[model samples]
Target chain A: MNSNITHDLAVPLNQEDKAKRAFVTALRVHVLQHMSGSMKNRYEDYVKPEAQKRGNTCDTPEHIHKALKSDFMFKAYSSARTCAQEMVFDVVSDSVDREFETLRAKAKPVAKKGSLTLDDSVEIPKSVSEIDVHLAPGSYHAEYTEEDFATGAVYDNAIEVFSFGQFGKDSNDIGMTLSNYVRLKFPDFKPAKILDAGCTIGHNTLPWAQTFPEAEVTAIDVAAPVLRYGHARAESMGVPVHFRQMDATAMKFEDNTFDVVFSSMFLHELPLKDIHAYLKEAYRVLKPGGLLWQMELPPMNQMPAYDNFYLNWDTYYNNEPFYGTFRRQDYRKLLTDAGFGAEEFMEATMPRYTFVGEEAYKEALSGENTFDTLTGRMDPKGTRWYGFGAWKK
Target chain B: MRRIPRKRRGERNRFFQAEGVDELLSALLRLSAEVSALKDRVYIAEKVLEQQGLNVSDAIEAYELSAEQEAELAANRQRMIETVLAQFDNSSDVDDMTDENSKIEAAA
Candidate 1:
């Protein structure tokens, strides 16, 4: 956990942009500080140990089914708090959209650089959109099988947001914010083709679209519900990227199709076999000069003691079978073996706020914001989560 | 006569995790492990019943008929397991049961 967190970016973030970030930061603190007793109890009692187990025995989909049915106290708040909104699924979607809308309205045209191509090794099964994955009844129903796709009848609109929230700060909101921040940092560094593997609902995919307007951003997932939701979302947002019901491992696109293939919080859900396949697929699909970066849980090697224990909470207990493996893996080695260039792996923590309390943010525009300008995030936007990836160009 | 349909498995977990019952909780967890293993064995035995075309009633009768009959049933189970395990030794159907059994034994 050596602090390789250095920011000597040639250009700096501005006043208004910093303010939007702080709002989310304050929101995170708001939730953490002011979560009701029942909510607090939910985490300390059920969620904490559950996370500790990495969604293990107590974390089966059946467990969720059971909890939804019988855990009276647990559901009391969930039902109350979640009635109007569709849990984490919709709330963060709204927030990210709102933030981005602000960006677009202000004429901060997201700078773009490269073109995009499809990954050839992957194929979309005709029946992929048909079978009800994990027995959710209708989420993954295919077009040819049911004519549901053409009818425009999509299912589980909120599931994408709800389940993503289960990702906590690994939330799509944080990924989009920081990813866009990266775009701003390297405006000239756009890839021809982009991929979002394990894209559930395409929230993270949307950010790439915002960042690289010209790139043919492709999002692929094995699950049909989220992919359908993502397709619908992209259409609704007026951001067109090819959304397909395809596995991240054996994508149908050609080799060297994309200049950049990235995933957000996707690698950990895969079994070890699939992870290898994905890495291979990533390598196979990327052009001779391409980049493969993923935003993932802080590797155990990159974090402190309590954080190791904290992050490994899932591996030990949560049903996330690969959390520990991913945290312990060497991305640089993984990339080099995959035939990528010397990788840049650094973690970035945005000031919770632009600099609400501190003079750093206000002073940022005045050319005085230091890398360590410790400003609190606006509200609940605690960017405790970290980002990592490798480059080929 | 509308009854509030009772829940299966209910809130017993909460009861076990409650205060002043550390030993009880430990024993329950240990027993759960035991039962979970027994379930695997039960699953295999049920499969045996299916293979033998013996329903639950027939299996019970064979298991209960006399000392000799009981021994015969036991032998049949062992043979069935041998065959099935050979075909799928790596299957969790048997080992999942055994893992839970071992946990129970260790706990006890």
Candidate 2:
């Protein structure tokens, strides 16, 4: 089933556009499932034995990448995957462009509960400005006109097609799974104020508001267009979430302000230094005894070489330049370096809350992290979401 | 009017070692997508006409375009061809073409 965005700012796509999106989604799934399996079979049948003859075990990600470089199956898989990635944005861009003015007008804030704060002086980091970051054409921060929300609309619409139903109905599975994990895992930790950093369109941010209805939720991104669009989206859904255009590395909020600082699939988009900077900022803004929680792909150390290579495919083929680098870092060291004690650091792999019901999810939390070829993949088998956090002193 | 660029900014990776193989693959995929889109549009048109109590298949087969209609359809076909082939011309900016098309659409 094709999952289309139903928000107020959603672009109206014609039948052909919908078909194109559906085709792209199917193509991506086919590549990820069938082609990936074929590539692995070719590796096991031919590439591995050849490497063994050359005295190379092909144990590292770099080795696996190099070994697969000349393989025809790998080449076909990579090319098709790249084409589908580009087409995801291309198929949705025309509809968004046609309704750009209407979407901009619709994005006007009507929220009675929350507010939008755009900082004109907030510099767009080179990581976002220079690269398209997932081959998404304009990246996250591009502005076509005054108060333009086209980028946000494009992202919100295309993500459903891109994720291929892995991100739940509203593309908020990451937030839903993580927030539920936090709430269930730490039953006594009641947060009154929450902050979501690098919250593009607030897809993941809204779940926090839903999970903890009493918490005053605030979300920040460097892009004004996305913040504006996100504000309108939250308001239309009757979920009050304060949206702000502020860099995560240098947030405008005062120190020790939030009871919970949250992020999901956000850290891999930044450079290693920026990741460190953002974590330190998260540490500073979080109140004492607060939690710094994030949902991300498991670290490289937690997986074997093949799984690492499979997960880091985005680093080589996709536009995520920092993906592999971020994964290679020691998760424990990252939190500890940012002032959280090593003893207070926590990690968990929980089943998707939306997929498996609450009871099944709660039961699955005690399960160990499963590492295989599909650990961080979009396959049905990889239903687990990895999260780690540390409690402030 | 300003148009958003459909083409992403970056160096495109060539997966195949053979010359023109990657380009051929891209063109083939584009063709497949276009074919799929066209099939869907035709299906929707047929269904809508059928729901209106019109015999779409018979009417479509029996109908003949007027001179002006034929000319318009010819121009649309040419535009579609150009749109499909524009990928080969690296100098052609998709945003610019989209802007020009929007101007034409507005004029129409």
Candidate 3:
């Protein structure tokens, strides 16, 4: 159950920290799985009926959110969940503090194969600097000293605890699942250059390099600390990745430079305008006939009202203000507006490569979409990843 | 050591309607986490001692405390209880009272 980080730059946790992480993980599971069920029951049995009496249909996620504002069970669930979120970061940050020097030393060795390019001029976007996205303290950009990667260490370690082992052993299941899907689905298209945009610590980025070893893997993030840690992490793992500190919205890469531009769970953190800008940048950087695939939560329109309300909890409570807004947008239209041919736009629901083995996943791919209320959710029952992309022409 | 900020910016949402309830819940969860950590550490110590060929459970069961040790333990327990209960004590506020009569009355 303690599927903690195994990489070289992994923060060393004492017995108490490990236990705290376990407690937080359990608390999250209880809140998300068990208490969430109770909240839904309360809504269906009590809140929904009460709303109906007043001629309110409770037809949308916003309506459901408004109705549940006064519900005690919902309040308790939210409180517990928020506490778990804070506790996870607190425990991990403590561990990072204890081993700050050790981590810095570990991250010091120059990459033999991989490389890091940090830019001091890149302005930290307000979306990240203004608030701690997902309530992660420091928001992956803060640095106390020159060449500090504590925020990266915090993120890499805290997310493993936060995910509750749902994101695979290395917390790279999103990348692993999506990259493998592209490999299997389109066997003929061999990408020579790959780019992972907004790859925080390259947890999801490294899997793409592993999936396609021949590809020249490059990952970019606006934050320099994460890029520094990610560079060392990739080198320690013996994967050659080019880590650069650059914003995805306005990438430094030339036009048609990459055969594939990928992002996993990155877009939702951006404001609507930034999402569009990032898409345009992605389209510009991708070569003709190349792919721009992203692994994201399913759109709100694809889900029932209740599930929309459930998934959008992060938007309101988790400090991800743009989460619901991104989900509400038409994903296909977003791609088409970015200059991707509408006919070339494609989307798929594939099983998580690590959860369901490769063979089972391949078999499932040709089968039904297999998307339900649990798709893209952190629930243990949610085994599938929803991916949308368009081939540049 | 340089440490990342544990508290995040932005207005924190209050889930409970009553004042201080949310803070109380947070404190309760922290207490629970501490309890769980203690349990984990105990289990880890037992396993580690077992690996070193020490039967911890047997030793613990057979152990007997002398009078001095017992008194020390009792004092320690009392100290812990007092320390925990001291957080709820408002005597410090009364001590800081500017009015002389109110201080004497509060002490009584």
User: By DockQ, who's the top model here?
Assistant: 3
lDDT of 1 by residue, A1-393 (tens): 001111111012233223222223222222232322334355447764665475534333334333333333333322222221222222223333334323222221132222123233444433333332222223233332221231112222223222323222222454454456456556687766788887765667776777777778888876553454456445555676777767877878798898778887777766666777888888888886676767666555545433354344344332344666776777666666666565444344443222132354223333432221112111223333345566655
Candidate 2 lands at a TM-score of 0.86
- Order the candidates by lDDT, highest first — what do you get? 3, 2, 1
Return the TM-score for candidate 3, rounded to 2 decimals.
0.86
- Minimum summed lDDT over a 10-residue window in model 2 chain A is located at A1-10
lDDT of 3 by residue, A1-393 (tens): 244578888776554565467667766776677667778888998999998898778999999998888888788778878887998888888888889888888887665688999999999999999888888877889898889888888888888988888898779899999999999999999999999999999999999999999999999999988888888888888888999999999898899999999999999999999999999999999999899999999998888899999999999999999999999999999999999989999888887898888899899889867557778888855657899999999
DockQ of each: 0.01, 0.20, 0.24
Q: Ranking by DockQ, best first? A: 3, 2, 1
Off by over 4 Å in 2: A1-4, A380-382, B33-108
True contacts kept of 3: 0.59
The candidate with the higher lDDT, 2 or 3, is 3
**Per-candidate TM-score against the hidden true structure:** 0.47, 0.86, 0.86
User: How does each model score on lDDT?
Assistant: 0.46, 0.82, 0.84
